[model samples]
Target: MADVTQLIHDYLRHNKKFPHVFCAGCGHGIVLGSLIRSVHALGLPKDDVVLVAGIGCSGRMAVYVDFNTVHTTHGRALTFATGIKMANPRLKVICVMGDGDAMSIGGNHLIHAARRNIGVTALILNNQIYGMTGGQCSSATPQGDISMTTPFGSLEKAFDIVDMCKAAGASYVARGTSFHAIQLDRLISSAIMHPGFSVVEVFSPCPTQYGRKNKFRNAVDMYKWLKSNTVKVETLKDPTQKPDDGRIPIGVFRDVEEPGLEERYFELQRKLMGQNR
Candidate 1:
């Protein structure tokens, strides 16, 4: 209900630590802006919000925001976030991770968390490489792409995070790029408000890593690629089918109702306690 832009401005302007560590033209800033706006829209108490970030460039986000923030080791943010949400269902737990963190070493945890329908919103900043680790090829790295680990070109296929989340039983799954500002903000808000596991895969650009290696001059050029390549959901279904032209689909792919993990845990606890009495 609040003006999303204003809310983002207020949060970033007042928070001295934020927008500083975030690299100029970094998608982390965009996603953080959208996330702050989403939290403002939810009208949740500041004390009740918990932000968990995994190790990476994106992980630095936790250090900036004013909240119950945790910056954990690589690929473990979701696990910690899930535990926090389960222990205190009243808190709003959000897991922020990079592409490599969520899709590589964290893949198993990512899927399992979705399978359990943990009441935690997971946001992946998919920049397609291990940016902080010097541009190693990550699971989300596009096929035939070049990185520090793949000097010639990567032979492995890239993981479609949205599809993977949907298959893993996430209650809500969406994909948005940094270019789609309004849609990203809305999707993030929806993911946060969802009752069960929710994933918002944000296709961002890693200018310092992926972009430079691939010949883009800077981050703005990478943004142009994101803008030009992203396709609308209404224009087509089955986003897995890649067009020869290279357009990528970006929108809410799937949403279904499911019992959240914390609620089920409490229900079982209640029954067990009754039996003990």
Candidate 2:
């Protein structure tokens, strides 16, 4: 990873934009930091990187970074990213979306993208609630959790983003949390390098909206919760770690190398063009 000072100087926007829009302890800031370091560490050119975001708290991530950013409609960031990838297969497209933005209205697009195995990185920041709009229960909100919409606790089960992407045929799928900052940095880097559809479901915390409503004392407590309620993926082999009902696993869940959608499409076009000659 690049030096902290250098990472900030190279990736951040103008210095005048001091206080970022995120809450004091919101995990979104951490995610942004990890993302910057990951991109810098990989030595990717700033111009070559395109960051696409949807309508949510996560959408604001694009504004602070110096990368080519596209802020699209609710749950449709993937569509724009797909278009960009098809037009220029060499560009590295990364979509950053909040849990509600990625899994709710945008769920169908995500499934189709994964099914096609497109060459784009989908970085889904799963805060588990509709933080920016209202403290509403999102598709990722845990069952039996209170929210603006689910006053009496949500009866619907939360969507497992990693499993969904893997089942939908994405070439790479990984899970990481804001608490594990270093791991998240590595995970994001790996996802960007992986070909075909890549999904990195990051369990970010919404201290302002989701925290106060839940039992969390504060943002620090939320980070502690992430640390306690999750286990590393490497430790799953032992039978001693069998009962992990509430505790989630954190690490890469799936990875496979294969040709992406654009590669296949362009290859077909090339073959047809040659045939016509």
Candidate 3:
């Protein structure tokens, strides 16, 4: 196994895109690291991969990854990814979206993409608040959480990303935190290998913005909260076990084989061509 430094050096565009814009304790870097390791573990050719990201702190991931990358407009990463996948079905399309990007402006696109079951992997880095846009309360922000836009308290309920994806017909849906780096890598690799639409919701922490407002002492405290509050999906299945005190569930919620949209579309085209002939 290669060392962490070597793995980063080999997979990241460090020479050109070094000195990332993420805050010192932001968890986006950990999520990105897991993504790179997952790609490496799956033996994917970098040339065959296309990374798309929307406008946000998470969007910076496309810049650092050494792949065919696109920084799309805010909330448009999924739209661009869907087009890229349809145009070149051979390419592996991966989208990185922030909580606000995925659940607010891009919510419709996220659901429709999953409904079509396109072979694209969406990684929603859910930091709760809109970290890039001045830490405003986003759709994923938990109830009662304070933010710039919700100084009194966020009254809106949070969206369950994994549940939303599963309900949207995503073939693969999973949730993980930045703290679980190794497990996250495995989950991401599995999602990439899945043949249909996949959604991986990564609970990343924004120490500088969201953390400061939410009364978290620091990044370490935020991570500790995540570690203590998250329970695996499998564990929750037992009737004896119940998640309490605002514990969130994490792990692969769904994974099943299905023909992706690209495959079905090509099949339809073949049939139409035969009819024409």
TM-scores of all models? 0.93, 0.95, 0.96
**Sort order, lDDT high to low:** 3, 2, 1
Please state every model's RMSD to the true fold in angstroms.
2.2, 1.9, 1.7
The alpha-carbon lDDT assigned to residue 210 of candidate 2 equals 86
lDDT of 3 by residue, 153-230 (tens): 988999988888888999999999999888899899999989999999999999998999988989999999999998
The best candidate in terms of lDDT? 3
Structure candidate 2, residue pairs in collision = none
Clashing pairs in 1: none
lDDT of each: 0.87, 0.91, 0.91
How many clashes (backbone atoms < 3 Å, residues ≥3 apart in a chain or on different chains) does model 1 have? 0
Cα lDDT of model 1 by residue, 1-277, tens digit: 4575666665553546433675667788888888887788788877888999999998988777777899998999998998899889999899999989998989999999999999999999999999887899999989999999999999999998988998999999999998898899899999988889999999888888889999889999999988888888767755556555778888888778787899899999999999999
Q: Tens digit of lDDT per residue, candidate 2, span 1-277?
A: 4378677767888753767888878898899989998898899999999999999899988988999989999999999999999999889999999999999989999999999999999999999998888788999999998899998989999999988898899999999999999999999999999889999999999988888888988999999999999988787875224334768888988889988999999999999999999
For every model shown, the clashing-pair count is 0, 0, 0
User: Candidate 1 versus the native: TM-score?
Assistant: 0.93
What is the full ranking by TM-score, best candidate first? 3, 2, 1
Candidate 2 local Cα displacement, residue 17, angstroms: 3.0
